[model samples]
Target chain A: MNAPSANTLGANAISAYSISAAVPLETAAQLEETLRHIGATRYHSLHPFHKLLHGGKLNKGQVQAWALNRYYYQSTIPIKDAVVISRFRDRATRVEWRHRIEDHDGDTGAEGGIERWLKLTEGLGLDSAYVESTEGILPATRFAVEAYVHFVRDRTPLEAIASSLTELFAPNLHEERISGMLKHYNFVNPDIMSYFSRRLTQAPRDAGFALDYVKQHASTPAERRAVCNALIFKTNVLWVQLDALYHAYVDGHVPPGAFVPAK
Target chain B: MNAPSANTLGANAISAYSISAAVPLETAAQLEETLRHIGATRYHSLHPFHKLLHGGKLNKGQVQAWALNRYYYQSTIPIKDAVVISRFRDRATRVEWRHRIEDHDGDTGAEGGIERWLKLTEGLGLDSAYVESTEGILPATRFAVEAYVHFVRDRTPLEAIASSLTELFAPNLHEERISGMLKHYNFVNPDIMSYFSRRLTQAPRDAGFALDYVKQHASTPAERRAVCNALIFKTNVLWVQLDALYHAYVDGHVPPGAFVPAK
Candidate 1:
């Protein structure tokens, strides 16, 4: 077998390193620190598009593309949560998780995160039916969101939970997004931005439980590595969507048949 | 329900039209014509990346990105086929479909299509391990591929079979790819291009059976439209992968962590 190259050392390197060397276990605090470090360096908040978005550099059309594409990701969350819930055999564990479904889907007559997201799309002048159809969203948006669902369905339960740890960084990004969009764009308002406002609270609560679960359950060093890698994977899942958005909308090379902002 | 708009007519307009009107049934020959129309218009061979790659306009590195990104799609064929197989209750249908799995993943010692694809990547100088890890492929590649597997797993069996109808156009593209790449690039060799050579025969035999299956089984107009739409969906799956390639490689905006063509 070939030696693990020096470049193959972090998240993507797990498979290579797992075969050759023992990953040293971290304490709970250390694991938390490591996860935080991943958030610091790898999170989508640091992505260039987010910088452009929050800095008021993008025009309204660009912002519309972001909202339209992101709706695809926002809408898939409950489905991902449900897949995670299905994987758990214990009723109590599922009961604890069922709140996530409620949080996204909402009770009868109550507005949910998805409906709130649609309002944001509508605020940007996207037709509600078009946004709901997801017909015009970028291919990368569909792929990234769908990957999240499949990951939860297919990964070990621990890794699935660990992937959710990206939520640990979510509240801060939501804060940035809400304040930035409201301040910069004429179209933004409190009602449409409610999704971010709601997520600011919901994400932290969800992330806390997930972080605690992952830290406690991923006891072995290899399992810990997998947990870290899963976060990194989740980060990529978020990051790549933005990358596609930046390439298509920002760089102006939108693929044929994808959403094109009306000039 | 709203009436179907004059604009909402073909494969893409199904969801709109389905709610509004009774789709007129077509004779077998007419149904075949519609499927062929979808192939002619929507197939990925029409993608710019294919034109560049086949025309020898792309450098070796750009070619490498295409091959590596495409490896994800090629490798998943067996898994998608297996999902389709699992959906079938009849032993005869499953038996007929099992050849797809076998074609992708050959018997012991006889290299399958996937392995042959790796030889193409390796010929372009990518490490076999990195290629297999799929760590470096485009996110769109993964999403498009996983969507395909999920579609086969979750959609009705007839729709699942119809999605495979993109193969109806595959043999001709494979022929073009082989001759064009051979004529242009010194890096292209018979051994590396063997995957296409093999598929020239295999895809036709497979597409023939699938066409017959879909043509015979989709007895109603709605079902036939669904079959046509499924082909269109599959074509989009293929087309979008190339679109991602073009956006990233040709347009010179390789997403932050995707495969970078070596200078």
Candidate 2:
């Protein structure tokens, strides 16, 4: 097996299907290490195009393309989070993941990550109503995002949170995005970047709890592998978003009916 | 906006979202003309890459990609047809579309379009079992197909049949597909082409009845436009199928974690 980047699976190594584990558990730490390895090697922030996106090398069309495709992911995160919330018998676990939902849907107005994402879309000249309507998201993005929702709804709650262990790598993502977008795109402002800023603080603290629970609860080797594989699945979800974005935007091609940024 | 693709809006075209006129008193010829127009302008059979696909220009990967992605569509056809069948007010329409489900699903063992499609997948080097499980199909394909099922499940029977309007354009697609595969790929054989031949014989005859029903029964301009718009939306659904396939296959870009064709 490959050594995990950053002692975890970061973004660079994405497996189409996670390696099924068939091993004895040495200890909880080793299981934790294996899961973290999945995060360090396979998490999404490492996609090259995201570097371009955050670094501001992309044009307004590209930025609009990013936001539009990402909207599919943004709109569904709450639903996935809710799926986790619905399954937890442990109120503490439910209470913990509940923050993730609140973090996305937010409270009243333009407060949460989703609303903040709308601001980013608005900054890129996309209509907020259209962005919210999700009329313009890539078909792949919608499919891929909904698949994640299905996973949470259908899988065990522990597995659902395990899927979110991709967040264990989020602090690093926030770091790169903050500096990169500020450097690259003139349209980006710190105000619009507040969404990531919040996620930056929130994701790791949240992921830490999830990681702790999985390592402690997922006792058997197979169970631990499922936990690890769930994060890998989550990374693929994020990675596919970039795939759709790159095919539509960076290649100077959009599918026949996907979002076309303003000329 | 761009003159609507060489087809002028008919003098009788509904000008707004307002309710259309009461059901037109029309000959069967008029009913046939309206559905043919919908097929010519709106069915996904007219999509560019679909034209490319059925014209024998697609590479093996492209065909595999189509087969893989389209398995989602083909598999869902029976389920959606079942939804439409369930909506039948009369024994006649239900009996008619019941043949559609039976034709796609077959009576027993390896007989239906679903089974024939597996033969095509086998020819493409995909495992017949995995293909049947449909575990690896693109999420976009799943959602678009499921949305079609849900549309049939949720809407009035007229709109449900309206959604099937894509079949109005299918006879030519089936021919193009059979000829294209036989011409382009050595792996394709008569057994694999059985599905297309069957669809060629069935789609138009089925479409003929539905079109006549819609034209005769959509008494008001509102209902007529609803049917037309329903057909248009069905086209969009079908078009998105190709859009996802092209983005994934023609472009050699699969969505993150979707099935990858083996050489």
Candidate 3:
């Protein structure tokens, strides 16, 4: 097998994720390194759209477009996590993962991550109802995000957990976003951005459990490879959403019937 | 209820197709008019991408991107039709729909519509295996096409038949495509473009059966409205695929992991 080329993660390469090269049985440290390498190279943090977003190069309207489309992703996370939990028959695993649903969709009185996401979009001048409706997001956003849900629902249980491994890299991006958006955009404040601040802790704890589960359970090299592939697929899911935002809002080609930010 | 607005079919509207207004009981003729009006406004034939494609304004690479992405939709039709078939308990409907699958998948030793689609892609210089693998098609293509399948699977049987109503408008686009490509691109020949020619007849027959089924079966005003909404939904399905093509190819913002036509 050929060595994983830098081009393996290019936007236009392939649908299903595969390893860059043949798998060989490896130590836990080695497998972890491979997973981290995939993140370093393939994560959505590297996307130009994020750079534009965090760097504050975008206008209020552009930011609105981003938040509006992103709400769809944010809203769907619990559904995806629920699907992941459903894939496992183990009660402990289900109980361990069950809190993720609560993480996004809080208990009776407390607001959850989805509510926090609304604060961000609402702060950006998007209507809360419209954001909740997901009526105005890009078709690509809907497609890519739904694709993630389907991936989790359809793939093996190990792969579903591995797919959430994007969370492993999330704390860093969340860190960058909170500081960068606050520093850069006048519209951004700590309250609207509380989602990230909270995730700084929640993500690492979640990622830690997931990472350990993956490392322990991927018993064979082939399973190890599947774990890595799932991570790469998750990154693609995250990456493509940004690509859609960049294409529609940044490039000024707002597709017909999507949200049109006021001039 | 508000009359159907000009923007009801806009590209970025709410997803699940709903009527512009509540259904008032209507004659069969009124319902048919509503469905026809939807096609005139919302069909992919009206998309700028198609105008460019048929007018030969796109370069060969652009055409290749179109064909490559569209192959995903073409390949999914049989699967979608089968889902439609599965939804039906009526043997007459099943027998009627069974031939649609045969037309696409073909009997032993007979080349099907999918094979003809590969010929077009092959004529455009795309590898047959690559085209068949669908690894390079856009995420939007997969999402939109699969959304159609799910729509069929999840909705009532009448809506499933109504979703195929886009075929009512397909023959005209096929004729325009055949003549336009033959006249404008030397690389396109009658042999390579056989898929459109075949669809010219097949689509009308399929559409007629579907249209009659919808009209005859939709007994109530709400049912009639659903029939119209189903056509609108189908049109949106077609419209978004072209919109994805336009964003990726025409606007030059190809998303990661999709087909990038040769330079």
Candidate 4:
């Protein structure tokens, strides 16, 4: 059923299975299973660009585009988390969410996820100023990241928390990325890979809380469907960034005024 | 200087000229010149995809892709305009801005921009329900349009008004598209191209007010720069939609689950 038949409606087909009928509300384990099924099929790890990236098939310029464009996404995580926090009325829930902002932005003078992301870009020869300014990334990158912030700001709190569940699938991808890049690319090393390493722990803790919150809060069939749709939306955000990178860098059709890796 | 040089940073170079030096503010005419210069160089009309589209170089499927993806952008205009209206405190200003929402959404039974846009899509043999659902659009299209909404929601009212000044460059593109698409493609006709025909009038009226608003309100040098940058941001929003279309359809690398034309 996942194979997109001629009669199926493309990307909409993935959701069609759940949306076609009003099934009975699932138990906690069943809901988790449904969420996991979404991750298994639709995560960005399944994207071709990730294949090229982790397999070391991408050249240095392509890799630079990946890091440079991805910096925008990494930097915006704290902003989106903050927006998510603002939506919560409960102090305990807000306190639980505040850790996400801390993880990305850090306490005074501490290196946060954003700075670690810069280390990866700097390792690949992009200027910290330029990366921090986010002036060189693909337009798709900006749009995708900004959309995530808006989604959290505008969607219901239940949906916002569910969106963060993409992190449940993230750790495995990070592990593969770290080992694959370290094994394959001469330029990639432990320091430059620190962002992924840190995420291996942070993502699981974050995803665990988010998953629990969603499982507990999504009390009805419709609420459960919205939760699933939010995860799908977040995955689209990640997948589109890679699609833009692959289009511009690997395919070598850089839009006028976008970043072009030096020969 | 417009050509991306080997030493120059890619798309970021366009903004470099502005960031490098802070110049004195100008007369109304000079400010208009600067705004038009940004449009001349960065408008989506300048994208190669537009050249392909207006030149009738793209096939029917390609045109369908263009229409389908752009429906997401067109449909969201009222929502973004509503967000813009929410930001204004002045009663007179809100009244003036309210026309934008009406132009898109229309009065009872009056065919507005969104409905007219559907005529274009339906004329191309796409189901109205499928088009309205927007379930098959490129992820980039969603991200780009959503970013524009967020920009309006998040930025100051002055900047939001300036962003709408992109309409200044719209009428001519509409004229070109109407004539070119009509002359070149048999599927295109005055009935189907009513959206463009309508916009030719609507754009100028809207752009005139927005342009005057931006020029009058952006009093300081920094404020003027922000206005110019806002227009540039809006231009990027439009350009990126075309870029996504080109990358996905023209480049033959549609992301998994996006619309794929039947053979």
Candidate 5:
């Protein structure tokens, strides 16, 4: 198959159904390489929306639309993690995974990633209540985010854990975003950007753990392929969110009931 | 709220959160009126995609995209109905509901709705395996269709049954579609259109049962409101699928991985 462009929006580019592993990799190291390859090629960082976003070509309203729609994805991570945790019977695995939930939802009085994400939207002049409500976000955003949650809830424990492997690619994107938005968008500040900053450290730890788990556990070739497929599915989940944002905000074909940015 | 146009694409038009029942209706007649009102404004029959489809403004490729993507929705109904049946413990309710599944899934040798739908896709020249695989349908279609399945699985049984009330409006749409497509597109024929033709009778029976169940069970104002909200949510599920189709196929912004119609 011809190599897909970085900017191609269809998940078909890295479809889970595609039998990419006709000759599956034989070692954990090879499996790890395959996972990284999927990340490099299919991750949302390659989406054109990210290019427009990080390059600061978008107006405040456009950026606001991005943040608002994305808030659905951000808020859903803990719930997805909870579903992931539920998939495991092993107490140790559950213990390890439950912290991911805490990292997002937080302990009493401690700010979690979701609360911090709201600060970004809040900094962008969006009302936190409305941001939390998720009422005005794009329908596509709701679908994609729910798709992620359901993926974790429905897939096998290994596949669920592998889906989290997208976090392996998150740190670099987060770094690019923190620096890019602060550099380009005047409305963005370090405090509002704290979500990505905190994620820089949090993501690597999470990704490392998930990566090791997938490699150690995916013993058979078909199992390894399922792990790879899960990562590809997760990337599609991320890529489609940006695609929807680009179609609605960038192309200016926002559906009737989605958030309409201020004039 | 301003009166939403007959063709508004957003579910926010009939938002379940909108507190439409400021003074809850005093009788089932009033509640039924409110539901019919929601259908009049918010049902997917009002979507411009449907208008384009039924009015014969779309090309053969566009109609094919509609049929192919719609097959996902068509194929999912039995699974959704099965989930609905799972929600009930009563023998009468389960027995009543199981027929809905049979009507779609069929008995051993009997033909079912989904097979009829496959005929429509096959008639349009889509590969039966490809359509059944659902590999080429829009991401938005998967999300919307799965959203309906999850809605039935997750929501209260009353809310679940209420979601099916969209069928109350389906008979008219099926009539319009069968006549419209056969008249406008030479690619469409009466044999391929069997699914909608059959639904003309089946939908009314299903709708009558569901509507009566909702009216009898939703004795409280709050329950009645929940019932209305479920219908609105279902309409959104249906409406977004078309919005995605319109954006991808008609507007020529098909995402990288979705079905690309033959030139």
Candidate 6:
């Protein structure tokens, strides 16, 4: 993690990013555009490694690396979803979000996304206990995952729901991952990619629900701004994970005492 | 701002910093020590620019920068304090915390910390309206400052109070800054330094009351841990500001558009 060579983005980059132009987005569609712009520009979906993974270019170990690292995110989803669930006072909203927990945790063994995620890790030759320990996960990954949990736990219920709108884009990301990895990575099995398959359906419904919730509930201009800002914060949360991964593994200055793959 | 690259703590340096032997400490004292540790390591007191400003090494422009950036933090104090105030159901606790708001916002002209802060800003030749607009502060500074405000708003009351325990450590930092800045920076007049003088007596008293409350109230190990974690998080909240500053000014990649000094 050597001093990342001064500012990673440089001063000009900061100014360019901060020099925000105020375009009045007129519709929820326009609002959606704002959210999407953040994702297109800021989401981990745009990260180069993701491009490599989805384009069918990754090797077995690299795919293993992705699965192993992503496991922390998978495990934390229910916990984070539960935080959102706890915030819900409306019986209907709670009932809907509660299904999300069930979807990830599954009613019984081998049923939910968590179980399917295990299949991916198992396919990658990761020990379930080690994976569950989450000790070996990149600290950056841990930070990003936990940050999402904190977001739900700490934000106003609406803002929490708004932050989860990242899921709206997740379905698209998953489809590309499945197709790209299937076509490219020989070590990956379509069977093992079952987790993304569930996400393909689950993320969209959840994202739609969240997006509609934000659109409808963010009734005031100020509320709309908060919702927009919430999504922006969330995009950063995901992007920071890549920043960590790139810095740690790709950039070769991995923080000391973090997971080091066997040579 | 352009995408911030992976911030490396230098793997080897981070590694060397990680492996300390566990010398068991009193759970209570250990908690206190952990809180103090966060203050020592992450608190804004450690920022080198703080060193330059307080040690009188900075020019008028730098002092202006310090006042400008710091006012963002000071302005939010009452708002954050108010949220914490709202949480206190006990009339006495609420009454006590009420003083914090009064101290920061001022009851009348020539009184209160908020008024004093403005005086300092004016003394530095900043327009009151410009400082109020907060148009010139760094984005990182605003986020970090808001994070503190949000912490008090979102956390449980005991933990919110526990987070304020940084005040116990602050009086000393204030003393250092005041003495050093007074000695080093000619732009810093005694009246501008008056804010620290007031904080010297006030912060310690406020902190003493808070420390007693935390020690007496956070009796269980789990509660103790939460209190300790709040302090740690609070420290990081402050520390990240310094990291942002160093990355910008010191590293020379000053994220494109932070406070640029007058030529």
What DockQ do you compute for every candidate structure?
A: 0.33, 0.23, 0.41, 0.42, 0.38, 0.12
Clashes of each: 0, 28, 9, 1, 2, 17
Candidate 5 local lDDT, A44-91, one digit each (tens): 898888998999899999999999988999888888888888888899
Q: Per-residue CA lDDT of candidate 5, range B1-263, in tens?
A: 64333223244335423335353455687678778878887778888888899888998889889988888888788889889999998889999989998898878999999999989988998889988888778777887789889989998999999999999999988898999889988888999999999999999999999999999999887888888888878887887788788878887867545688898
Native contact recovery (fnat) for each candidate is: 0.20, 0.17, 0.23, 0.36, 0.20, 0.14
lDDT of 6 by residue, A142-257 (tens): 55566677778877999889888888778878889888888886667899899988788778888889888888887765676667767766765665455445444554444334
Task: Compose the digit string of candidate 1's lDDT tens values, residues A20-109.
Answer: 243344566656766776677678999889999988889989999999989888889999999998999989779888998888788899
lDDT per residue (tens digit) for residues B84-104 in model 2? 888877997777778888888
Clashing pairs in 5: A10-B256, A10-B257
Which prediction has the highest DockQ against the true structure? 4
Q: Compared with the true structure, what per-residue lDDT tens digits does model 2 show for residues A1-263?
A: 86443243333233444543333345677777676666655677767678778766788888888877787688788888888899978888777678778888889664788888888888878889878767667655765676687778777777887888888888988888878887777788898888888788788788789888998889877787677778877877777678667866887656434567767
DockQ of 3: 0.41
lDDT of 6 by residue, B1-263 (tens): 63211122222212211212232223666556555555555566765656766666666766676678778888888898899989988999998888888888887554888778888989888889977777666555665676777678778899899888889789888888777877776667689778889999999889888887887788776787667667755665565455444434443333223566666
DockQ score for model 2, please? Answer: 0.23
Runs of candidate 1 exceeding 4 Å displacement: A1-23, B1-25, B252-258
TM-score of 6: 0.65
Docking class of 1: acceptable
Q: lDDT tens string, model 4, B14-71?
A: 5522421233345566568767767777888888899999998999999999999999
Model 4 TM: 0.90
Can you tell me the CAPRI class of model 4?
Answer: acceptable
Stretches of candidate 5 off by over 4 Å are A1-13, A16-23, B1-13, B16-23
Docking class of 5: acceptable
Clashing pairs in 4: A257-B11
Prediction 1 global C-alpha lDDT: 0.81
Give model 2's docking category.
incorrect
